[model samples]
Target: MFSSLKIRNYRLFATGAVVSNIGTWMSRVTQDWLVLSLTHSSAAVGITTALQFLPMLLFGLYGGVIVDRYPKRRLLLVTQGSMGFFGVVLAALTLSGHVQVWHVYLIAFFVGVVTVVDNPTRQSFVSEMVGPKQVRNAVSLNSANFQTARLVGPAVAGVLITSIGSGYAFLFNGLSFIAPLVGLTLMRPGELQKGHTVKRGKGQLREGLRYVKGRPELIAPIVLVGFVGTFGFNFPIWLTAFANTVFHGGAGMYSLFNILIAAGSLIGALLAARRRSTRLRLLIFAAASFGLLEVLVSFSPFVWLFCLVLVPVGMMGMTNNISANTTVQMAAEPAMRGRVMSLYMMVFVGGTPIGGPLLGWVTDTFGARVGFASGGAVTLIAALAIGFVLVRVIGVRPKMGLRNGMPYVELVPRPGSRAEGELASAA
Candidate 1:
């Protein structure tokens, strides 16, 4: 399960990421809390969230293209450094009492721009560090590491906000980037995974679009993730609002909600790591289940009850995410992996910018309950639609195939004539 950590470079990266991710989560909590404290409006908080993620939606494809064309390691070093600087600037502004809503908006937008390039590079870089054989393990472990940080970071941020102030949380997050920078610099160049360098040309973006268009199974998962990510996974914003308005609590309750969700996510990541085969059918089922649970949780009358449901919600979410990630990576040709992963990142993160504010507006106009319910309903419908479409696209008959024995439609493709001939020859 922990086999991927045996790789020296990956271990270093993982360690640095764990430390850095904690700070990232810390800043996230504080940032939201600060916005709410200043504006006292859920819409303002939602706009802040949207600004932070909007760039990824707009420029993520180009970022992926750059990752495919350039040296990923060098790119990461630069991006990480830039993020640290941005964090420090925000911290300074907040500490000096010069911070305004517009300042926050601008800073969030800048960070989103940096993330457009950083996210795809980071995702593709993992395979280079651990190799294809350990890719699934590496991906699962990476998410586990992230969620573990989520569990620790929010609780710590809550305490710090209550004690020191939100500015200190930002300061800590700024400093946290140092670990990853040092780790990147320390990696032996000889130990790095060499990637295929694609030639830059006109229509490269169009080429990627066409590449995805050719694979319906691949397209199905991307669509499924886009829906779930945009609608169902607005927990960071929704939970914060819910805790404050509905539960009549503050940072502590927000932290508790994140902790419960992260607990379930950690379990989901561990289970995913143990799987020998990552299948698309599992992805669909997980996504569908997650959406359904979100709808159920929306109706909860108590904070504890809402938190309780997040366990299953988090579990299914992680399952869907890891399964989609592993399947996409495993199916793509090595030469096009960066491009495909970029599209995945674009759909996944980009959806948030579009969805966040819309959901926020719904919450503001109606109520958090209705807003959450609407998002969940959209996710459930999308998941079911994608599943049915994939069933037909993959040519999986209802009977006579091994898939019939399973519950959902698996994505593993059948052997072609040449592969069958090769098996006969070996026999």
Candidate 2:
């Protein structure tokens, strides 16, 4: 589980990433609160979220093309610096009392711009730091780092927002970028593991799309993640509305709720790190379980109960995320990894533009409960629908079997099929 950390460069990368990730989460919480504080409209908040992710939706695949064409380490420096600059500008505006919802939206849009390049580069960059053999563990540990930061960042942001104001949180996040920058500079390039990079060319983006489109195993999970990401992952809108309106709580309560979920996610990530293999079927079940948990949590009568339910919700959600991410990263050819991952990120996060406002509208018009329930129902339906498709298109056949005296699912693939061969080692 801790195997990847033994690599000196990855150790540096992970250390720096943890610090920066905390700041990232801090900015996320504070940014949403700031937008809501200024506008008092969930739709306005959704707009900010949409602006932050829109660039990824539009240009993420192209950014992946760039990642494949350039040295990821150098590319990261530029993108990370750009994001931190936006953080600082936003902080300065808020500190001077000149911040507006529009200011937040503009800055968020620019930050999203940088993220289009940064997210996929950083994801695929892991291959350069550690070999494919350790990719699964490294991915899980990377998520563990992010979740651990989530546990700390939001709770701290809530206190900071209530006490020092949101400006300080943004400023802290801006300054925190220095850690990763320093880590990158300190890396030993000679010791790094290298992956394939592409040369400049036309139709490269189309090539990546065609690559995934041709693989049913690949397309299946990507589509399922799209639904889960667009609908099921609209927790920011729902959680904020529920904490403030339904539960009648302030930043502290909101922070506590986030903390509980992060704790559960941390547990799930660590457990995933212990796994020797990942499977698409596990991802399916985890996503379905996550949707069910969300449905249950959305209807919690009390805040404490809601928070308790969030543990399993976060757990299954993280499991689905980590498992799918590992599978996708492992499946792609190294040369096309950037573009493929860019498409994955594009679907996963870029769809926020559509989902955020839709969910926000559902919250504003109908109430947060209906919005949450609707999102979960959609997610549950998506999982079922996609699972059926995978069975039919990929020729998945299932049988009941016993393992350690416990009944388990056994997949019997069609004889002499591509997907059947892929499924043999998919885990």
Candidate 3:
């Protein structure tokens, strides 16, 4: 499971990310609580969340193109620095008591803009640090490291918010960037693997889309991620509202919710790291399970019950994510890997912008319960739709027997045993 750490550069990257992700999570919890406290409106919280992810929806495709054309390491350095600056500005504003909802929204938008470029570059950059053989392990460990930080970050943020202020939490996040900056600087240039360079030409984005358009195994997972990310995985947006409105708890309860989910996510990532294959069927099952868990949690009457449900929610979420990521990376041709992965990131993260506000509006208009339940229902429907689409489009059929209480889809290639050919022809 820890096989990727055998590489020195990845070890450094992983170590820095562990620290930085903690700070990132810390800032996230504080930011959400701060916004809610200031505005006392779920709509404002959703807008803030939308601002943070809106760029991914608008510019993510372009960002993928940029990741394909540029040196990922250099791109990361610039993006990371930009992110740190935003953190500092947010901290400064909050510290001065001059911060308003619009200020947070603007800063969040700025951060999202930087993230539009940063996210894809960072995702694809992993393969450059560790070769393709270790890509799966590296990806799984990356999630593990982030989720591990998640567990610590929110717990600490809760205490810190009760002690110091939200500004200090933001400051810690800003300062946390230093570790990654130093890690990047200290890395031996010789150890860095070069990423794929795309030929500069017209219709490059179209070309990348066409590439994914022709792969069922790839498109299937991407669609599943889009559904889950857009609807089911937005616990942060709704959970904050739920804690405040439904549960009548404060920031502490919100923080506790995130901590529990993160703990579950950490375990999920570690378990995924042990897997050798990236199966599409596994992704489908995980996504379906994640949706079902969300539905169950929506009905929970108490904070403890809600928190308990988060364990399976986190588990299924990480399973779906890691499985989708590994499948795309392993399936793509080396030359198109960067672009393909960027497209994947675009779908995965980009969906949040549309989903966040819509769900937020649901919470505001109806109630937290309705919002949560509707999101889960949408996820279930989307998962079922995509699963059927995959079977029809890929010419694959689920096995007659149930495995793990879910229908198992087996890849059924045409007579030539060329699934790609079948997919391309169908497309």
Top lDDT model: 2
lDDT of 2 by residue, 381-401 (tens): 899888877676667644433
C-alpha lDDT of all candidate models, in order: 0.85, 0.87, 0.83
Candidate 1 residue lDDT tens string, 150-175 = 99999999999999888888998999
Clash counts per candidate, in order, are 0, 0, 0
Return the top candidate by TM-score.
2
lDDT of 2: 0.87
Clashing pairs in 2: none
Model 3: CA > 4 A from native: 392-394, 397-427
Cα miss at 2, model 3 (Å)? 0.4
Deviation of model 3 at 230, angstroms: 0.8
RMSD (Å) per prediction: 5.2, 5.1, 4.8
